[model samples]
Target chain A: MSERGKPNELGEYRPLSYFQLMEVSLRELLVEKGIVSDAEVQATLEDMRARGPDAGARVVARAWVDADFKARLLENGTRACEAFGLDVPALRLVVVENTPQVHNVIVCTLCSCYPRMLLGLPPDWYKSRHYRSRVVREPRTVLQEFGLRLPEAVQLRVHDSTADMRYLVLPMRPAGTAGWSEAQLASIVTRDCMIGVAVPDTSGSE
Target chain B: MPQVAARPQYPTDHPSVPVRFAAGDRVRVRKTFPLGHIRTPFYIRGHSGVIERYCGNFPVPEELAQMRSGLPAQPLYRVRFLQREVWPDYAGRADDVIEIEIFQHWLEAVKT
Candidate 1:
């Protein structure tokens, strides 16, 4: 059995929350009705847990090195990722490139609709109401909170993922990194970089 | 016993509504709100913006939630609104903007 929600020092397990109880009931019903096997559900959960931002990082790294790939990625993100052999099934990805004049960021004002297929799951703060509400209202301030201070001249473009589309920020490649291998470049393309909250730091890569 | 059919799969290329606006066209989001699963954000309602790009068509989310065929699909566009226009006290740069994906039904063309 999973050790989730383990009891405290008293050795007594706490009751499941309302949503947790509902989830359990639903899962049980689905299994009982043969809609989905327990093994399939468990495997899916494992698959979700196994996903990480490496796929996204590699894509960014490839974009940095290959102009053709970058053009394809910018024009059709979903097709480019698929052609790259990444499993982006049914994902209508919209990639926003960041440049010297313009900076791009993403926020789902309605809810945390992130590019999970590429970047894995979203961070807790990304889902928090604080980030969701404030990011769209005052993005600079929110970005500042994340230690990303943009120059006054850089125009900020905040994307609200409100509908059938998903967004990924293509952060500008930092300077002083010449002749770097694709793997080395990908190492710096962290999850936060793709999410637009943070940029790749060259200082840590070397 | 009656025969049951498999769940219908709505193809992404299914017949959709005509695209009204194009890139660079000025448009305004409709302010009206009806009770249902609406994808349009409340903050963008009644605001004017420029069509950044046409993102193609997809099933209407409102109808999808009601267990109905959301067809024909609706044309969606990425509308770019100036931050200052959206929030009067927006502290970001004057050129700072926010873009949202809105369906055709929620947008009306803005006269120059």
Candidate 2:
């Protein structure tokens, strides 16, 4: 046994990822390194790949059209979810509304506590530690970097979702969606809108 | 009540069968004491918010790392909210909405 994960001065062993393991090529290396197995890795990837954006999309789509639904979301988020045909039995839910006055963004400091149910798998940026640590303190600058300019009048809020209560962004309806049907409204509901970075606009979405 | 472990290790990957919450679906975040490996941040717990976006289901990172509960990862959402509503008398900017990623395990139906 040479060693495992991090040699002191003589250079014995060290921790590694898949790419790293490929370079070393040692079965014992895997056992000692505790690398995630191919079976597990394959399963995780398959599981992730199997996930769809429809469930979360439907929630966002509904919020875009129904006023009463919006109100209910504000009042009782979990209950309101039921009106839209969601089945949330034991888990707790919280609603976060987006208005012109406030622009909200979310990040997970520990790992990534994403609203996957409503939005789907989080974008690459959301998982980056850069977005997680920085967004909480400097959200305005981050949003600006993402091409969303905010006014001095509008405040920027950063929420870190932990273990207890999960959050969602109820974006303000776009200017021209008054006559649009629910399907139409949902179509324009971009992931960014749900994230509160940009409002839903048909040009880019279409 | 069986005494819960102070902190337990999570699993790498488990099959997630989630029950989703749709828009206008009123919900509340149950206040749970910190336990095991989890991804939900520390700042937004307890405070109530609204559902903004329904992100598609995916593997929960903390769960995948085998650092938290073994519950299979499921679909999640990106909810939005007002800064004023979450925090009061805060004079940062006037207009700001808070968006977050909430999992299915932490949601409860809001009673009308």
Candidate 3:
């Protein structure tokens, strides 16, 4: 007998989920009406997939080395990013600084309204209901779970991206990497660091 | 004679509410439950906080979600509330806070 339903690349055939079915229906409808071509949709998806946290790391590194750029970033995140040659249209960007006295984290209680242009897509946990509800209520506890235990003396600022505005955490530069170049410094700025769940560690850097 | 400064040119047709609060101003999130794409989180309703910054005006998200022109843009601000105040049992420093972006329509000036 022929293999049932022709196994997929993973050697398994499964039905599309509800949301997947809806997305396929919508895309097909749009294509049928000539609203958008299939190629255009594919290209857009490819563009989105190509984006990563490298741009955000570069911005963070630049801010660490240049006080003026850091001030600009803190003042107007969108414009500062545009000046950096990154296209972040429509959505308003807000950069929160993590100083010695305060630690900043980002959350979207309503939904996951992240700074996608800078940091690409958000992580799975960021979109989870658990993280959304708990982070705002018990930040230190949540941070502790992420292996980021803040001292009682250090204040925590949790930003809830509830509206059109998106937030990016400007984590403090770790010491001992004093004279590192921007590219070298950026290497230490991980995606989690920009999300405020982790900080840049120089131990792994050369 | 003091020279009068010229007012900056603004589009008369632009739909925008006047900015009422500045940074450092204390305001309370309006406590109301209206349906339809409400951006204001329920946890923050009726809470008092200080304005962290004026985030300029933007089209109302609720209206936009309804496929309506969110014209006469509403002023948005980052309101900062102490975590302890937001949650009585908040497990963090007293200085810990949460900043949320709220539209002007959802905020009221704290009565002095």
Candidate 4:
């Protein structure tokens, strides 16, 4: 279980951080102690991998098509998501609406607390120190870095996902998307759009 | 295998402590730096804001993070603060705001 100071074929040794070493020790102890089986860990990994932006896209697309569903989602996010067969577990999900005048962005300053059941693993940049620190102070500038330039009139609202609750931004439906099918609309909703960094390009669907 | 008891569920409607603030209430975040894991960010500490919504009552994360019984659930509120207020040199528009979910323990009602 101890890989620290282990020499490689190239006669080079790489040291693991205290946190990494503790993680390895704890994991091995758990497996050896029969608390968590290797197969169970693999299954959990597979489950996490199976979820992605596609699920979030489906929810957003459904909300766009059904006003009642959108209301439920805004009112009770976790329950509404369960209607779509998404398991929310003990964590509560809050869906913030992006209106014509207000845009929403999500960040976790303390740690990468995200809606993994819906959005999958957050992008590397989302977990970076720069994104966590800068997004709250200068959201507009951060959004601009993502190539999303909002009009001056649109107010920027950054949601700091700090607690046990998870947040998902329900971006405003793009113009000219009228009469668009749910599947068609879902295809245009990228991960960045749901994260509030980018907007769905409606012209592509047309 | 030890028989595990059903875990306690802390619902939003039922809070262990008395909720002093509600949505639209003016509140100021406490500036205390308690040891162990905390959800309150440093930037928001000692800052004033308005409660945007009542998120729900849940286990106090500070205790939960230490693997202790997060008993006596605390109310969590979504507080909205202007970016300019949070940062002195905030380059964003004055109208821009950031919302953070904070526990009841870290907030005090502002004397409006």
Best by TM-score: 1
- Per residue, candidate 4 scores C-alpha lDDT tens digits across A1-206 of 33455876788888887987887788889999999987887788788777788988999999999999999998878889898787768658889999988999999999899888788889999999999998898788889999999899998999999887788899888888888899999999989998899988977657
Measured by DockQ, the strongest candidate is 3
lDDT of 4 at A96: 90
DockQ of predictions, in order shown: 0.46, 0.23, 0.53, 0.47
User: Model 3: what TM-score?
Assistant: 0.91
Per-residue lDDT of model 3, residues A1-206, tens digit only: 12324576778986776876787888889999999998999898777778899999999999999999999998778889899898877657788899989888999998888888888888999999999999999888888899988877788889998876788899999989878999999899998998899888777776
lDDT of 1 at B112: 89
Off by over 4 Å in 1: A1-12, B1-11
| TM per prediction | 0.93, 0.54, 0.91, 0.90
Candidate 4 segments whose C-alpha is farther than 4 A from its true place: A1-15, B1-15
**Which has the higher DockQ value, candidate number 3 or candidate number 4?**
3
* Alpha carbon lDDT at A157, candidate 1: 95
TM-score of chain B of each: 0.88, 0.67, 0.86, 0.86
- Candidate 2 ranges with C-alpha deviation above 4 Å: A1-47, A87-91, B1-112
Candidate 1: Cα lDDT at A75: 85
Model 2 error, position B54 (Å)? 23
Kindly report the fnat of each predicted structure, to 2 decimals: 0.87, 0.51, 0.87, 0.75
lDDT of 3: 0.84
Clashing pairs in 1: none
| Candidate 1 structure quality by residue, lDDT tens digits, A115-196 | 8899888889999999999999999999999999999999999999999789989988889878999999999999989988
Kindly list the per-residue Cα lDDT of model 4 for residues B1-112, writing each as its tens digit.
1122122122454447766676778899999898889899988999999988877678888888889868788878889998898899988778899999999899987887
Q: Per-residue lDDT for A1-206 in model 2, tens only? A: 22334684786655766855664476546746787565665575676565555555567777767678877776666677777787654334566677777666666677676666566678888889888776665677777788887788766767667544555777777786677777777777677766766666767553
Query: Which ten residues in a row are the worst by lDDT in model 3 chain A?
Result: A1-10
